[model samples]
Each structure stands twice: as C-alpha cells, then as structure tokens.
Target chain A: MRISDKYRYLGIKLTPQRLAILSYLDGNRSHPSAEDIYRSVRKEFPTMSVSTVYNTLDVLKEKGDVQELTIDPRKKRYGPVNTPHNHLMCNKCRHIVDINKEFKFTLPSSMTEGFELTGNHVEFFGFCSNCRKKQ
Target chain B: MRISDKYRYLGIKLTPQRLAILSYLDGNRSHPSAEDIYRSVRKEFPTMSVSTVYNTLDVLKEKGDVQELTIDPRKKRYGPVNTPHNHLMCNKCRHIVDINKEFKFTLPSSMTEGFELTGNHVEFFGFCSNCRKKQ
Candidate 1:
C-alpha cells in the first residue's frame, strides 16, 4: 500500500506495518480497541504481532495523530482526532456513539475550586438499542 | 470504630476487612484506587491484602454501594454514589474535583441512534493550580 503524505507530516517512521495501522485508523469511527486493530490487520500481514500495533499506536499518540480513549473501562479504544465531540456509551455493552455537537455550559466557581479551568467532555451512559432490547 | 448502620442496609456479610474497606470509601470523594485503599487500610489491618481490597470493591460494586470510575485509566477509582454530579480532573495530576450540579441535556434522535439514555456526566479536563505552577 502507498504511504499517505499525512503519515510523512506526522514525522514517524513508516514501516509497512505502521502504514497499515495508520491506513486502518484513518477515518475509522468504530473506535476500535488495539486488539480489534491487531485482529483485522493481521489478516494482511500474517507476521504482524500485537506489539507492533501497540508500538505504532504509541508513536502516533506522541505525534498527536490519534486519540486514546478510556471511555470503556476494560480496554482502551482509539478514534481519529477530529472536531471536539462527546460520546454516549452503553453501560452494559460499552457500545459508543459519537455526538458531534458541542455543548456550552459554565461551572460554578465553588465546584471548580482553584483549578485553572479548561475544556470539558460529556459522557452519556445507558443501554444501546440492542442492549436495551436484551433487558 | 463502630460499624455504621448503613452497611447493614446493603445486606452483605461484613468481615472486619470489608468493613475497613467500606469505612475508607464512606463519604470519600478522593476516588481512591484499589491499591490506594490497600496501602492505607493495611496500616490498620496488618493482614489486609490488595486482593482483599479488590474483592471487597467487587462486592460493593455488585451491591451498587460504591461507584467504579474509569476517570483515571491506569486503575479503577472508587467514589461515593450520591446525588447527580460531575467531575473536573487535572490532566497532569489526574486529580478530581466533584461538580455537584446536574446538567439538563436532550440528544437529537440522529445523534442518539435509539439509545435508551439513562444518565450523563460531564468531565472537565484542565491543568490544576498545582500543575499549572509546574508548567
């Protein structure tokens, strides 16, 4: 596969496996876990080990090319760094859907204490349609 | 210390170690990790082990007596389950401050995708005064 010019801009070494990982992540909204990436990419590069996926992800994370999310407690998930958005997650199944709108709100200074305030994210937790049906 | 009457309401057998863990978590907003609880509680119960803390936390989680938070990804943090609230965390220190106000939000159907939304929590990420000083 041809390496994208964007990978060049990231200033990381682009091995075949790294290129493959980056290609997989590009525009991937599934918010795949590392294991998910490893399982899918290994179909092409049979020699690809899980470690390679993690190492490439670490490099990309350092370059600010991707975001690592702890939205799911049992495992970490990755998504493209994009316009500021929040997530809605299934409390039972951990399914995630991106909410693209931005929220505008202010916190009481009493609650914030003396911390220098910054950006905020909202996480909506509930049963997804499928999980709700199972209930 | 007296075993508080609240523990009985949960209907779990409370061993001394379990009680110690419960006492540590009671009204505690520090969001202590299992390891943090083990280290502190062991100072009192010489035989208290880390696994015991984890097991007690698991039981408490099952009983819905305490909340398990993934706010700090490296380990699970515990917090009191009280009135609806949110958190502000320092990105550098991973310190959390409770935001005790509820946000009223409604999601557009296109964004929700048939999710049976239950609740939402807002997380504000920023540099705390201590971390800002170091920066």
Candidate 2:
C-alpha cells in the first residue's frame, strides 16, 4: 500500500514531520510505542518533540490508518497494519507479532446480551521464539 | 462466590486490606482501574497508598483471581470475573460492560501460522447509553 496515498486520502496535510512518521510506520510490524517512534524519527529530525510523535499517531489513529495497542501496560504501542487482525505478544521479551489468521467464532449470545457489538480485536499472549530460546 | 474461600484457596493472606479490595471487585461489572480501587479502599483505610493497590492486584492477577484489562488507553482496568469472557467498552464515556456470551470460533490456521495459541481476549468498543444520549 502506498503510504503517501493513504495520508492524502485521509485528508491529512503531508508535512515533512508527518511524512517522516508515516515512513517509519509503513509496513512496520514491530508495534513500536510513541517513545520508540520518537527516538527513531528524532535521528532524522533532530528537533522533533515527543508530543509531535504522539500527535501524529493520534491523527493517524483517528483516520483509521493505524491501530493503537494497549496490550502492554507500560506504554501504548502502534501498528501500521490497517486490516482486521490479532496480535501475539511475547511475554518474556515483550515482542509483538501479528497473527494473520481469522477466526469465525461469533460472540456468545450471553456475552452480547445487551450491548451491540461494533468491532472486536482478539489478542493472544505467549513467549516468542527468541524469548523461548533465551529460556 | 465466597470471597473468603476464594482467598483461602488461592493461598493469599486474608489481610483486611486484601479483603477490602476483593469485596470491591466482587460482582463488579464496571471495570475499575488501580487508581479507582485505591480511591475506594482509601475511604476506609486512608493510609493506603496506590502502590499497595497495584501490589495486591499483581498478586491477585498472578493467582488468576483477577484479570487486568488493557482495553483502555488511559489506565489499566481490573475484572473479578475469572471465567473466559469478552468486554464491551463505551468509546465516549469509557464505560466497560461484560459480555458473558460464548463464541465457538477457532483461530484461522493462517493467523496462528507458527505461534502456539495460549489465551485470547476480545474487546468491543462503542458508545454506551449515557454517552449516546449526550450525543
């Protein structure tokens, strides 16, 4: 997918700062947090503030061009994958990998008894290969 | 469920503080954060600190008596429900309700390609009645 086109389609101004952030997130599967993004992009834009990174992520999330992951308690992570998917997190190393599989199970009638289900995200947690190797 | 027995079986010390926290979580559907728990418990034990609440929660989580919810971006919420379940959160008010229904979906092979499946949590987001009314 063309990152540039996605930003334009979302009506976001293609500023150098935003473009830099977008380029970093393009095809990024590591699910980096705001700090990670800031540190990485700051290397290119030395004067970029952490708040700007957060702002860009917020805008991207609002535009549905990215997903904010709350699976980790310490920090908020972001994923550039815009499709319906699930996550597998390594409990030991804190690495997050995407699980591209689809599950056909419907929400139990009892669970959805009252509220209307709008969207769902399924998350799986376990140790990754690297973490397992360390053990 | 008997809070007393639950604690005893879990081998956790039945301190007055722990009991107070457990009572607060019992039958609680409005998922509360650590700060919420500290505030509520502090009404009786004014000396209680936030760290204590977090420590108790960490212990409870390890024993599988409580579940830590990461669906909210601002803070971590806790649930007393021990069974497998899903959550429905209000996007506007941030109210979280329990969905007790069971879904019989198996993960698609492609999604689980190589990683071992351990556990899953499904989260649903939308506006609750109060927020809907306001809108």
Runs with alpha carbons beyond 4 Å of true place in candidate 2: A1-11, A83-85, A88-100, A104-119, A125-135, B1-11, B83-85, B88-100, B104-119, B125-135
Per-residue lDDT value at B67 in model 2: 67
**Tens-digit lDDT track for model 1 on B62-82?**
444556676776778876555
Q: List where candidate 1 sits over 4 angstroms from the true fold.
A: A1-10, A83-121, A125-135, B1-11, B83-120, B124-135
Best by lDDT: 1
Per-candidate chain B TM: 0.64, 0.65
How many clashes does the backbone of model 2 have? 8
Worst 10 residues of 2 chain A by lDDT: A126-135
TM-score of 1: 0.65
